[model samples]
Target: MDQAETKEWSRRYAGKRLLRSEILLDDPLFQQLINTSYFTPVPSIVRNYFQTQCQRCGNQKRSLFGSIPCYSCGNVHVYCRKCIDMGRVMTCTPLYEWTGPEMDWPHHSNACTWSGELTEPQRKGADCIVQAIQHREKELLVWAVCGAGKTEMLIPGITEALRHGQRICLATPRADVVQELLPRLQQAFAKLEIQALYGGSRDREATAQFIIATTHQMMRFKHAFDTVIIDEVDAFPYTNDPSLPFAARRAIKPEGTTIYLTATPRQQHQMQIASKKLPHVFVPLRFHGHPLPVPEYRMCYTMKKDLATYRPPKAFLKWYHRRKHPERQLLLFVPSIRLAEGLSEQLSDILHDCVIQAVHASDKGREQKVQQFRNREFDLLVTTTILERGVTFPAVDVAVLAANHTVFDEAALVQIAGRAGRSPNDPEGEVLFFHDGKTEAMGAAVRSIKRMNKRGGFR
Candidate 1:
């Protein structure tokens, strides 16, 4: 191939491992590139004729593989069902990766444009991240409390990586986080181009050195990033889904750094830390230097019955009417979508002067509703656990209507309570848990909050 043609192909294929069908060229041109030793084809499903595993998602379960009659090859083919939503990975298909030279990323003398200074705790965490990248550490866990300026702490490490011309990706499990982070990152590094990708994202064509994407988007990458920062590492479905971690492992280079950012680390991670198997940094206080709001448990014995009858619980009503800060926005967390919608309507009836809305994962207008709430367009928001993490609403008092429900686990309850007291101006916001009965999860959540507060030097 000519120099000009090679450059054109290199620009498209560099740092990307794509299926042959995803390439925008004809078979003849693709063959020419392969023959020139620029592209390498890897089996999509490696098999021993009995056991099969998907190379993309790392699905090895025998139950997740199924056979389908093939049209191109005119034979029965086995496909991986686990990640079929991304694209089918069948036995006949092959993944293509560039075998050419690496792309030269641009380096800036001053990559971070944020003028704000980090607090002492945040600075300590930032140094840990920077050292991990500089030393090429395989993994580093950042265990910080909620509202601890975790995102700001990453600025220094990202800046250091950018100055070294290393590619960085900050991936999370939720799309809400990707949307929330895009503008912040853009303003932080105004000179560099950043690609924010999620499901149905419009910026799929651009490949930038800095990328903020959903963990699921990492499935499309292979050995592409030098530093992979997994934000909200403890939040679902990343912690619950095995494929997500697999994709994260596949996206980073063999010797790249992986950093995990979370307010609440899972049990396994805690054990690893105790055993001295995982290197970590801890930031126990929020950026505002205030104590976490410990949730107050209120018994509403008729909580389930009231929801069935579409009535607001009397206990919740009393607290709402007698709140210390009536002007503060309210986040009413429910366990299920039906309860969220029903409670929203019931509250709207009683609180005639207040604007109320309900949002869930499947809500098509969820993004708009959340933005409107942030604009103070609404006074109360009824939502499911989807908003339990990766969202920040300053000056909001939070309440979980069914804190005793099976859905309200210890980690989830802690994250929900964290919604309150995030803004320094309203650092004493209330967090109430109204339930029919107190459960072990609720007790554990309050204990966790108190432990973090004591660690933050709060009595």
Candidate 2:
């Protein structure tokens, strides 16, 4: 080939041969090429042609490789032109490495000492995870009730992977959860290189042997890990997106192990267990050795009769006032943002110097509210299902307003109840579900807890 021909071939070959395993956009050559008009800029298309849908809205219009500027965010994203027209940018990248030469594993040392020695239930849960890791199982469903020390149960498996020098990724659907787990995982693998990746995570450039990231952040990972653990597997975003399952699968080696941790598996997951398609492990109790609190069902009846006249039931109000602890906190869960806001306003009027804050998925002050809750600045937090998982407020009482609301499914209801009575100092608390009528979900939730508690020797 002539000189010009040779250079052209080299550029083409170099670009095509670039490993899709690394999702980092900081590579100088990759950035230059991405900026170059000749090369299409959508990494999702460049990595996974099957993922042509917009990550944000799941719209499939325009070329997967089309380049468009987001009118709303003023950010440039490679998405279908229709998505851009609709003013939504893809929220995830599809780049993932399915296979490559094995990478060197790093040494790991556990930093978090077992607060108390593992109980028998914890040990059993740990054993199941360890077995799955050793067997290179496709999936393992961990059925543990709330406060079961599910994170701690994974320590053995994670430590085993770390000891073998394997790269590990622990992903959850929520950023707050990613933050909540960072310290625990750090303590679990103290001497190992650990990177926590999320939207606002600090070390974007650092690649650690172990990573804890929000599920949305998994789009940035190419086949960069050997073992992947999906915590809160039944949570939102992850459960809603088929792409995340594909992403998690793509993020691992062909022989890599996958473990799922969730207290409440969906119907499909349950079916898998029934058919013997997936190995299942059950931990029916909390580590603190207490029964899951059974939520009492109280129908307001008035809620549905007059939608515009909704208010906390007099019974609920009296209970709230009577049991209100000045030092401890309370969490009131409502079905919708409108209800949460309305209740917060009314509660503010009833209590003095009692800070009542409203939190929802779209609230920009979410982090601040969470921090304030952690710092004990808020006497009460009125929220939606966003705080259903991965949040703990010791000695806090919990009330579910309109518990029969469509949003409070069995898993969600169980998780909401789990939020209370997590600390040993406050081993027990009340969970009241105020609703217009009883739901099958409410009965199931109560029964699920009762069953787990019975199995755990707590009943």
Best by TM-score: 1
What TM-score, computed on C-alpha atoms, does each candidate reach? Answer: 0.95, 0.79
Candidate 2 ranges beyond 4 A from true positions: 1-101, 107-116, 305-310, 322-328, 352-354
In model 1, where is the ten-residue run with the lowest total lDDT? 6-15
Clashing pairs in 1: none
Residues 1-459 of candidate 2: C-alpha lDDT, one tens digit per residue? 355643442322221212233333446754554454323334333225655654433445444446656676787767544323323244344332223223455454543344547778899999988788777777788898889888888888887776666778898888778877888777755666678888777966435667898776665444566688999888888887666776676667677888888988888998999999988899986888888888877767676643355455676777776774546688989888887888788778877778899999889999899888978887899999989988777778889988888899999999999988898888788888888878899999998888878887765
Predicted candidate 1 versus true structure: per-residue lDDT over 129-238, tens digit per residue:
99999999999999999899988999999999998889999998877789889999899998889999998998885478899999988987888899999998888889
Q: How well does model 1 score by local distance difference test?
A: 0.89
Alpha carbon deviation, residue 334, candidate 1 (Å) = 0.9
lDDT of each: 0.89, 0.72
